[model samples]
Target: MVDDVADSVGSVRPNCSRSWSNSGSFDLRFASDANGKYPSKIDFHQIGAGFGGHFWFAHTRKPGAMGGKMKVTGTWTLDHERTGPMKIMAALPDHGAHTEIANYRVNATRGPGGRVTKQPGDGVRWVSIGTYMFDGVVPKVTLSSETPYGTGENDIAFDAMAFIPIDGQYHEHTVEADALFDENQNIDTAAPESWLNESPLESRERLYNWAMTMSDKILSMKNCDSEVGDCLTPHVGAAVANWRSEVMAAGKDPINHPDGNSISSWIGFANSYKDRPDSYTRPDSFDDDSRFKIRTKATTTFVSDENGKIVPGSQSASYANRTADTHLPHFVLELFRAISEDYKISLPDLGYRAKDLNEHNGEYTSVDPLRSGIIPGRAYSYGGQAPKLTTYTGSGEQRGATCVAVRTVAGGSIGYRTLLSKEGPTTAMSDFSDTLSNSQYVAQSVWELVENIREMFFDSGSFPVVESSLYNVAPPIWQDLNFRACTNETVRKVDGYPILRASWMPDHYLYHNGTAMDQSGALRKTSLPLMRGDFENFSTATIEVAHEYTPYGQCRAYVEDNSFARNKNPWGINPVPRPGFNPSSVQFCSDPDLAPDPEYSSYDVS
Candidate 1:
């Protein structure tokens, strides 16, 4: 839903989730980029690269700046990060606060360390402030920057808001015990918190699932009979990119020299951005104003002034679909940030400098083709172990039992991590866990790679496809605890639960060219690793779900079960955190015990 709800209070939809059906579908997405709509130009304060790169910052302290106001003219209101692909891309500045509609105050900031706070949440999802009755009107709810904080003392974030219609009856779960844990499944405390960290198990789950999905994507798609979008990836080039990144990061790039054919203008990124569009101008369908427009191409940059307001910088349409961080699409650049942030996996934990991720022919090998592990290179390829889209394995000639290089590139040794104490041992130990790093980077790298190859399939009239796309997987609703792989072949779980009996790994492998060959996946492997790759390809994937169903939903007792949400300010309400007085036998939700559907069969990943 929404990220920083700001000095006012955080407002998010109670039932919203980052993982949902129809996630990657094209939709009415409002990009939260600055449009320079604010009245004054105060010095803008920089926050982390959040929704739409950064959010709008303002303060009531400025003589003429009291903060901005947003009017949502609808029956109900909600906010979403729009961290996915969009059909309608209107740049809206995202951040800050609001005064009221139902007037529910929320936990607006991370205790002290993190910038954004979660009210009823993991903070990543849009948690609801509260659902209240509102008359059908032009301005259903108006949010203002004004807060109880002393003038100029607090800075308000003016960010994007989403307006939605809700059913007449909807409420949040209130079982004291069920609502007790933070996203980490821990009891709440006054202790300062780090909003960025997630339960390690959850992170590991995501990391593993991501790996299975990445490899499946590479292997599942057949070389298009007629070359439709270059079979959805640029495998060889990705490998080359990693290779180059390794060489370059160590200040040993051979391509950017006087004699070599060059692609590197920089060490990490390829200056391969090509022909651009003249301008991007489309009507903002969401905006009733006849003149408002949207641009799918790029968002503009703004610099803050003295009063926390911003002024437009020299940025233009070139930024369309490009993220400020990597100048890459959202799927690769921003999504990388999201996977790491949402799941709270650190790079060090994952092992990725990733300079090699986008290179032309960069690659790092894992000891076992299918099992995930890091081989010796410069340790550059962020998306290491991800199979190349155009894996020229069989296309080359090989001489060894396993794939071997026919001609080893010269400079690879100069900047290689192997050149250090790690030298001579060409590959890494077989450890499938490292596959997470491969999947994380491949998740992003493959998107644009596929897009570009498709264009080469046809012909791009203008700029490349740049978009922030969101992808997620969850167990089928109504069958909450019946999680399983398509068959017991791919997924191995505890009886009727989310626990994995063993770590899953991919079994599929690619054959290499004669004389010189490279292999992917493994023949020794019998079952595919937790096939989490649920895209157009039907690869098996595992969604590690750990739910605590404490029967928190509406109890069957009807009106006698009215919960604390309606208890004005609820903090003083009684019978909370599951006092011993309440029996554990109480039933809740449309179902209790999270019973599994007897006939469920699909392990859907979407």
Candidate 2:
């Protein structure tokens, strides 16, 4: 926050050194001041320069007329003198028509002296009109007629006005005589220009121009008069002194200075010459012109059955460890890791952490994502059992961090926090209290803007591809072992299309065309035949590699691979329960004749 020193009433510099006095008679406005009746003889003050067109009027007394009634309002800088009161004096032709004080308003200043019922002779006599107490060096005032003039003789003719210290009162000022302010304080004295709203080059150029103008105005020795010798020089220097004492010396930032400067330039004005840096990061080095793509990561998609079942034997072909494009899926985890590395902090990894029967008296809170469990990476499985899976639950239930709302903030950025709901048989949900920190809350506030983007991601119904080096495929290593089927290539070929092993490749995707095909050991490369058949039974069909490679060397997908048996537990026994199964440890039941025997088979740790 910038200090508001210049704006305070106590800091005003009085217009005391010289009397800001105006005089003369007859009907005249500042316009007529140079021509008609009272030609304003005083033109040296800023009152004339700052208000060139505005005027103070003087006229003969007349009732309800725009005469003898003048009101002028403007800023007045006073010397910072607390000891004495300044006197305000006004005059009129001694052949006076009664003119009572109309309205006198001076903020926190004192008094309009007793109105003069009589002045000595007809040659205009100046009486002690009003006494003004100084709140600061400068004070602002407005004066007008109390009662309208009546249709009488030419009685009240405003003659003159003056503001001066009540004789012999030593008035003081806040700024010193020799203080110097450079151009640095002029341009950089306000809020920073946002890079999102303006380009770096444009912001820099504007600042540069402002600095150059200030430099010329402040440093140049021209524009000086005999009385005020370079008036701006002292005031400008004073502004710099004020900035250093009030802001810089106190260790506050002079860039975006707090209190406004009286002069346009200051001590640190050179800082304005610095440039603003670019903020957006792009993946041009990765050869991926796609938006928000990370060259270091790729998305590996694992397809599961419609019932959300994880078949143990198919784990290897189904699980690929590549990064995703657009980055929403792994954005949080990646951000956390990056922050951890940069700050040298040991943040927890993104994985499950079952309640330890030892710590916290083994009485952990139920369904707490922060302590009890965490969803595995790439937790979002589209068109599967769980659409939103950022949150993890202690028990096997659909109770993870499900984002129901998002918010946007400055720079059009977004952040997301978890939302809890009670639906179906699950009565409990995870509230995001433990999910975000104070700083994270700021990020999540901005994240609210992602709701629209979230809708787009779901609507596309397609997975993003990233660089292949991101993930390592699981075992069952189908690509390593050739077909062990005791059969030749002739039998493996169906309708003249060769059968190939389904291996997880980098930057490759498996596409499913919403068609119904037989859940058999093998599938066809073409969807023309399958589209004609009834697909209702396969609402959530399986997808596999189509033609080993597309014409452009990209891999094509073939859905409904039924050649392999439905995956069973690696051993002949079901070792674990639903939702908590770790697909990484899955092993294939290689023996075709082997049947599950609950009593005979034992659970083995892979």
Each candidate structure's count of clashing pairs: 61, 49
What would the TM-scores of all predictions be? 0.17, 0.17
lDDT of each: 0.21, 0.23
- TM-score for candidate 1, please give it: 0.17
The best candidate by lDDT is 2
Model 2 scores worst on lDDT over the 10 consecutive residues at 406-415
Tens digits of lDDT, candidate 2, 1-606? 011012221212344232232221112223222235422223112111011111222222233333323222222223334444555544433343233222234442433222322222344444433444555544433333222232222222333344555422221111000001111222221122122113111223443343344334433444334433233334333432333333232222323444333122221111111111111111122232112111111111111233332211111011111111212222223333333443234443222232111111111112223232221121111000111112111122222221111000000000011111112101111112123232321223212212221222211112111111001111111110011010010111122222222222111111111111121213334322211111111111122242221111111222244333222112121211122222222221222232322111111111
For model 1, residues 492-574, the per-residue Cα lDDT tens digits are 12132221110011011111110111111112222111111111111112211321111122222112223321111101111
